[model samples]
Target: MAGHHSIDYTSITAPYKELCMKGKGLGHLKNARGLSIEPVTGMIYVVEGGNTRIQVFSPEGSHQFILHPKFAKWGRVDLWGICINDGIVYVSDYQGGRIFLYTLDGDIITVFAKGFTTNKKMIIKMQQPMGIAINQKGDIYVCEFGANCILILENDSNNHIQTFHYQSPLSIVLRKDGSFIGSKGNLIYGKKTSAIESNQMIYEGIWATLCWFGDFDSNGNIFMSDMKGHQILIYETSSGRPTLLHIIKMTFVGSPMGIAVDRNGRIICVTDSKLHFFKGNTKAISMYS
Candidate 1:
């Protein structure tokens, strides 16, 4: 891939066929902030702040259960970032600067990696630690909106291993290698050291905000949701050019925040109001095609 890539909005896919809007009394959700799919159970988890709750759904889009409706009592109002591993769910408290661990059944088990500080020796305040991805090795990569860095936490010891700093990092997706893809104003790819010096604008004429979320597809394509632009962008792994694959009208509850791909290569997105899942039949077609 080049140091910098450009985006061509005309060539990508748009408005996937399988669209489902579900609102089963979620009760005053401030914003559907973060989402993650459990690979083992094939269940989707969603989180919101004002309501201070987590909702789970089966792979088929059935309501499985809800967790932590009383999270406010735990002294946290701004809850963000959700990730599931081996039936255990991990959530980040943006206000508290701590990570809450819970059982799949909604039981608070333990907390880890609380109160992170940077090399400046100042207490690194995380305004919104939104993005989270767990690799097969059980390492957790956490992206903080405030610090603009991705923190690597060892799952077992809960020790801080390393931090990858970028220019206002909104989300991060860890690849099989130590390298990662991060979204700030544009999608970026590099190792930790090179990532710091690597500042490339992948998308132009679009306002990049917290709406950026990404997950890798079977064919190594990277799919992302651009919230401010109201579009879903895809970038080929080999060639970094972005293709504006899809555009959807924004709803009060639909901000296109989080995205993930299932085993079947289906695309699932979490907006402010609803969870949007799109399954394309074509086998990784190029956007220009």
Candidate 2:
């Protein structure tokens, strides 16, 4: 596959579709942040900070419904990150320092990991639960950016089972084997330990200001959204230095935020107000078609 390096991918520009509200009295996205795709249903779940709610869309890019967290019933505001696993959807309470679980139909299951507790007493406080990813085991890994670490929670109980310390980790991605890739400042590093000292430095100088979100595709390509760079940086997971594969230039949404790869190998990204989709020329993406 590497031999076909003559492919000029610069022509791969513009998103296949741009999603926004279109009907009478139908609100548009303002300060929209995180996004995820449900593989089985092909539904896109997006979290809007400005609207303080989640909007679900069909595979064809039509507005389907809105997901308001149960906390919204009590006046919670500003939803940040989002991810869907199985039939369950998880979202981050960007400003509240908490996480909430919900059904695909928007039924609030429970809220948890507000902070750490020992013997039923709140002892450790999590400053923020920003970017999140779930493994096949139903364990959710969250980046506590304000605290410079990541925490693991059981999907069923929402209990904080493990924690890994890094230097101002913003986004996190989990490997099936239990290792993690995190964005700290302008660099991306791999950690097999929860301790900051044992980090295996992978890539540096990834973003100019902030590297917010990332996800790995089936071909081991790591696509990360660089809000400051206004581009999605693709990295090869097999290389020792993780070679740069391609960059999906974000012309429409300059400040790209959350990102996810759909089951069909399409890249889905969102900005402060727009949702964009793209298909790349990566070897894995090529085989995926």
Candidate 3:
């Protein structure tokens, strides 16, 4: 919140009449990608990747429960990136390479990691993890996208450590210099967060077209999504890098991408079926009062 911060965007209001949620069954939202907000019960944990399910809402949007995380040895769940530490709820399973851990009223609390091992250390596959980041010292950051690279499930251990290889080519996560990083595969024995500095910068160019995830906001800013440039890029690492600050053009009809930010900085996103609210640039009450 210092040096270069501007976002009035005309008091930025949108569907946010106290938050909104739209279309298609039980708590709604279809084709959605990811969302996370539970900083002590502002609830709202959506991620309906085409209805594979996980809805729970309440930062005013009401309806609080709609999960569908399957078991029988893992058989259904195609979600894609969501994070809410401490109360535990880090979901990612693009076709199930795994990364689940729920309990903010959803249950299940295991399988927090999956396949990865090559570079002559072969034997482990089934990884297509798409966008999942958590760094308040929990260190998760996955985007494996079938090993095109960025996996680190440290501390909450499941094996797989330190990996940052990127042909990235597109999506899940990426953004250089300022910090917020993602994939083609190669990493295991996980657990790393303050250790990627050999001149550290290698996720150059291409921030979105379909990036689909990234929601950090306790101050490090960063609330990504550009699904074909519909827009929503607001980075700000407070001078440690990542500067852009604001751009929320939104016109969406489908293809917006998941993004969440609340601890009062509200801005819950998701599209391809609705749920777009934005009420956080306050200061508008002099209209003749």
Candidate 4:
């Protein structure tokens, strides 16, 4: 858990394992950023900054299709974080300052929430909204990088239910309970004291953009990607102490961003260019235990 750990690539198995090869013609994936995997279908969705489109892949890594809004007019729609819940997919646009909702088939449904700025009076203005996650109850939590805070949006009402202000909250995840976990400015904060008090520092000295994606394992531990550190760090849910689990070094990948754990507890990571998956077995167990 302290230093670099290598993974056995030969033992990996998935539907699209062979498609992961370099220069495999993943269309419109230039500068790909955020990614999330569908639990039920095992399909992979990728976001590219330059293309401003969402690419869908089959569970086996075959190209299913590409998702882009027809006649889209939003300028600078750089997708940062994405999540799939029920049959809907949520994507956060950093430059568009809004969260876009789409069907599982990649059709733009609507804007789930819009970014806002508030002073003493609580006026709403659009800002750079990054990382997004949806809980079981369909509540969407969005992290605004420009505003340096997190906002919880009610699913049906479109009203801002709650706001957690911090120093550059890059990503957030809502747990099964009412509480949640988030990474802000190299520190991992959670609702330790109930009533949303941030008393936890999971790990420090991480890059400001360290935690781009995070997910909780079956054991209730949290795994997050450290973009600057170039590795995925696991933290005990109760204590928040980090144990280095896996270090991913591949061609054309410098910063690791979005991460998701499938139903089988396998870890799927998305970097600037590639999508990597690791079997969740002894390798993950040795790091956590």
The candidate that achieves the highest TM-score relative to the unseen native structure = 2
- Candidate 1, position 94, lDDT: 80
| Tens digits of per-residue lDDT for model 4, 42-129 | 8888877766777887765677888776526776567778888888988888877888888987777888545443433475444888
Where does candidate 3 have its weakest 10-residue lDDT segment? Answer: 183-192
lDDT value for model 1: 0.66
Query: What TM-score goes with each of the models?
Result: 0.76, 0.83, 0.35, 0.79
Runs in model 4 with CA error above 4 Å? 1-28, 112-121, 192-209, 238-252, 282-289
lDDT of each: 0.66, 0.73, 0.63, 0.67
In model 4, residue pairs whose N, Cα or C atoms come closer than 3 Å (at least 3 residues apart or on different chains), thus clashing, are 15-60, 16-60, 16-61, 117-125
Model with the higher TM-score, candidate 2 or 3: 2
| Stretches of candidate 1 exceeding 4 Å from the true structure | 1-30, 116-127, 186-189, 192-211, 240-253, 283-289
State each candidate's clash count. 3, 0, 18, 4
Clash pairs, model 1 backbone: 13-245, 253-272, 253-273
Q: Sorted by lDDT, highest first, which candidate order results?
A: 2, 4, 1, 3
Better of 1 and 4 by TM-score: 4
Worst 10 residues of 4 by lDDT: 15-24
Candidate 2's C-alpha runs over 4 A off are 1-11, 21-27, 117-122, 193-209, 281-289
* Model 3 per-residue lDDT tens digits across residues 77-152: 6887787778888887877688888788778878765465644475445477777766666767677767766665
Candidate 4: C-alpha RMSD to true structure equals: 6.0
Residue 192's lDDT in candidate 2: 54
